[model samples]
Target: MKQGARGSAEAGDRSPVAAVRVPAQPRAVDVDRERGIVSGAVRGEHTHSEQPLPRPRSAVQRSSVRGQILDALRTALVTGELRPGEVYSGPGLGERFGVSATPVREAMQQLALEGAVEVVPNRGFRVVERGTRELAELAEVRALIEVPVMLRLARSVPAERWAELWPLAEATVRAAASGCRATYAESDRAFHRALLALAGNEQLVQIAEDLHRRAQWPLVGRAAGRGRGRGELVADAAEHMALLEALIARDVDVVRVLVGEHFAGAV
Candidate 1:
């Protein structure tokens, strides 16, 4: 019996049902001996790994032309190149940007929705004229809405979170130093947006941004040497960094005062 048990003993003793083996998956073919093809290895010389993400065909065709025109138009409005009450035609603006009028019209329709412009019967679109009083009132409303929210966030949001915002605040400073009102306008709003977003309220951020955009657009003569100076912008940007520091330190009093001082010059 013992001699019989020793004859190819282990293999003979094991049951087929008790044998262990790897789970099955479709095997990848090895194109060469270099061996990156067993599992989870990328293959495709034609569609290289470095390729950018694909976009929808419509987005690929239309977003660049229309999106850029919209941004340029808004920049013109912010910098006073597009004066209040002045009318512009899609074809005319399209000629300026060297594209077809369809995209320009599309962009202007979006601007109209934002309340930045109004459509004329057939003349085209006109910049919505806002008086100085309206501009100041918008500033007041922004401060009234944002200041309390910011204060609350300062108390609850961690210092680490505020620290993450240093780069955004610094972006505003760089924009301020550029001495271009349009550039600073965009960066300033970006900073405010990052701050307000921490409140976790989508509606609040949307309302605040609409007011900010309206306030950013130059009133009547604001860009005609009457707008805020480059030095003032630098000072304002400094206040942003300072307020961020105060928030990081959880100094509510300082945050309140800095926010007040900041909005005082917003219009």
Candidate 2:
């Protein structure tokens, strides 16, 4: 007999019948337990075993968040929430605003490009410190660019075109009367931008805006400290309306004088 036949005969003789063995299939619970161990080890304490990880925000969502951060930061700068010469971390600002640090960082980078803040390596950003001399320099550059173009616009653009900007001018006056510095600053910017837009040169308008923003940074925390009253801002708004009226009247000489006086008094 063959060796397998001999072994089967011996088993049958000893036990009266042969017994067969089969392997057991893995259970669902055991499989799940193994997977849980792997996932928990990989994710550590920051993840749940049953829940999935969150996906990153989409590009559009990120862009919208960044824009919101930028606007909020601008408001903070204008309203003196972010003081000049003070250093701020992106994470800290994000925490305060209940957002992630990414948008705050992007916004700060934009503000840095606009000369509103300086980036510090290994740290964050410091608001640019402005002195009277620097403000004067900024005013001079603004005047040099704005005065000539405005005077030209006064002579060239039709009175009807100038009339279209009346709403923006009126808005500035109203904002000033409300005595809200942030609102007034924004309205003031709108008035200038609208005035510059009459020239129809986008580059010129952008440059003027940059200079205007730089000029405003220094006033962040100094309004109350310097005893500068809302009356001063109201007077400035009145002057803007007067300038618009002069432009509509095609009074180049008056516009020139007003532009000079405006820059002179800006500081």
Candidate 3:
């Protein structure tokens, strides 16, 4: 089967396979002396049977298949299509996604390492449970690590850089207002990534990337339906503009305050 496409049998499960099996008849029968009834008519009729399906591929057949699986899974993660603590069938997903089992298994392992999924002994992989409290804690962690890094960068980033970065930030806010959650969310992340790049610290950028990856898991889109008014978007733009101003002034303290307030308020 092509990677990421469902199999025909799985696409339409119309019947059970066990109902047509043939059983052997007993060559001899035993009679119950007291009840005068035959007790052993056929021993084959009581036999249990099982048929195992073939294992799906553990690796992708095509180079691009892995990335395709990743993107689909990422969307599902962000949209809550795969909720916390929900177990998924690797082969079943391969079937649904119209891919071989291999890419799904590989993707699941990567997600597990990211704390998006957990491996169980026998039950297999399940989505990691994340409570509102957990999200609040993540916000706190982001504030701690990110705010400082952003402030430091803001103090050094040139005004010309802001001209370039502001567009991404403005797009993020505008996307949110238009209820395009994925676009807004991705742009929001990109805006922070560009700001972090200004820090010139590779390690800090890497840490920020990991944190943002986790942040995408819980998602904030459906909530966008509540509406981010034009006024709200303008206010967010103002915040970004203020950060740029702080950068131009090389005011670390002001940048720090602004960065902290932005994330804290995002909650």
Q: How do the predictions measure up, each by TM-score? A: 0.74, 0.73, 0.67
TM-score for model 1?
0.74
lDDT of 3: 0.58
* Ordering by lDDT: 1, 2, 3
Give a tens-digit lDDT track for model 3, residues 1-267.
222234444433332211111123121222122334332212111101111222222333345765766666665676555655567655445544445445566788888888888876433467786655556677788888887667656656677876777677677667667754445556667777888887778898878877876765653345424333456545665677687667777788888788777776655
Mind giving the per-residue lDDT tens digits that candidate 1 earns over 137-164?
Answer: 9879999999999999989999999999
The deviation in Å at residue 67 for candidate 2 is 0.6
Q: For residue 217, give model 3's deviation from the true position in Å.
A: 2.3
lDDT of 1 at 158: 99
Model 3 root-mean-square deviation: 14.5
**Candidate 3: lDDT of 229?**
46
* C-alpha local distance difference test of each model: 0.71, 0.68, 0.58
What's the C-alpha lDDT at position 194 in model 3?
A: 81
Decide which is better by lDDT, 2 or 3. Answer: 2
Which pairs, if any, clash in model 2?
A: none
> Any residue pairs clashing in model 1, and if so which?
none
4: Cα error in model 1, Å: 99
Superposed model 2: Cα runs more than 4 Å off? 1-63, 219-224
How close to the true structure is residue 193 of candidate 2, measured as C-alpha lDDT?
94
